[model samples]
Target chain A: GAGVSQSPSNKVTEKGKDVELRCDPISGHTALYWYRQSLGQGLEFLIYFQGNSAPDKSGLPSDRFSAERTGGSVSTLTIQRTQQEDSAVYLCASSNAGGSTQQYFGPGTRLTVT
Target chain B: EDKVVQSPLSLVVHEGDTVTLNCSYEVTNFRSLLWYKQEKKAPTFLFMLTSSGIEKKSGRLSSILDKKELFSILNITATQTGDSAIYLCAVLFSNTGKLIFGQGTTLQVKP
Candidate 1:
């Protein structure tokens, strides 16, 4: 793809429901990132994937938040027992190199937990 | 913890007016600073400044980095309505490949 791509542009789920968001990064990009943005708030880093190394999950908010990158290309973010506060736009970005590389973002997935 | 701060949370300007957005950061092992323009959805890249005292420009948009001051400024000359968007600033940490972003400055240009 020419740029990063995300699935389910919008999702509305009830409380306690689980939701999965997918991301497809640009070809040959080795680094990928996931971020969450609440209404009127800045982006919050969630996770980062670099090659086959263990993902940097330091930013994951809680145990209910988990993500996985397959083949180092496509990634999935899963939220278990979603809460109303979990409603936000989930953004995915990818970069060609590791450090100081420019990131290209995908049209985020807007999740609304009712 | 790395932190990035942007001033003037929101601004409203008329077309052809010039505007400057500010960003400051405190990060360990700072490597680069990036600016992005975000509309309703995805954020589009604008400029990336690595070296101090150097300026990056594209069309009516220009940005300069001052490593000594730990800050950067984005300037838009003769702005247009299309230029209205949230301007975001981010700093990349060396080796860690982590990018910490500041709360964006929202610009609204009226025609």
Candidate 2:
């Protein structure tokens, strides 16, 4: 596609339930990133994948949050045992070379854990 | 501690008015500073500044970064109602390839 794309624009799940947010980065983009936007907090980085290098999961808030990039094209963010504090917008961005370049963002998925 | 900080958390301006948003960060490994305009869903890329003193402009929007000062400013001239949105600032850390973002500045351009 022309730009990054995400699925399930809106999600409402009960506490302790699991949810998966998907992201399809732009073609040939080598760097993909996941971030979350909350009411007061800024866009907090969650994880990133660059080429075949080990993903930088240092930003992940907890062990329940995990992300995987398949074939270096598409990515999925899985949140297990969702909590109400987890309600926020999950955004995905892709850059051409790495984080140094401009990133294209996808319409985020608004996840509401009730 | 927030590595990135933005000023004037929210602002209201009338059409044709110009506004300047501020962002400052404390990162030694900063690779670049980026600006984004976000509406209801996602953010749209605006500009990326890598060097100091050079300004990047797009239409009525312009941004300049000062690496030595560890700060940046985004200027929006001749603002329109359509320009109402949240403006975000982020600094990319080269070492970890992680971006530290600031609490956005919400601008409301009224007609």
lDDT of 1: 0.93
**lDDT at residue A96 of model 1 (Cα atoms):** 88
* lDDT by residue for model 1 (B11-45), tens: 99999999999999998899999999999989989
Query: Worst 10-residue stretch by lDDT in candidate 2 chain A?
Result: A96-105
Tens digit of per-residue lDDT, candidate 1, span A2-82: 788999999999999999999999999999999999998788889999998888898999999999998889999999999
Q: Is the docking of candidate 2 incorrect, acceptable, medium or high quality?
A: medium
Model 2 gets an lDDT of 0.92
TM-score of chain B of each: 0.98, 0.96
lDDT of 2 by residue, B1-111 (tens): 539999989999999999999999997788899999998877898998999999999999999999888999999999999999999999988786688899999999999
Model 2, which residues run further than 4 Å from truth? none
- Each model's C-alpha lDDT? 0.93, 0.92
For the predicted complex of model 2, DockQ is: 0.79
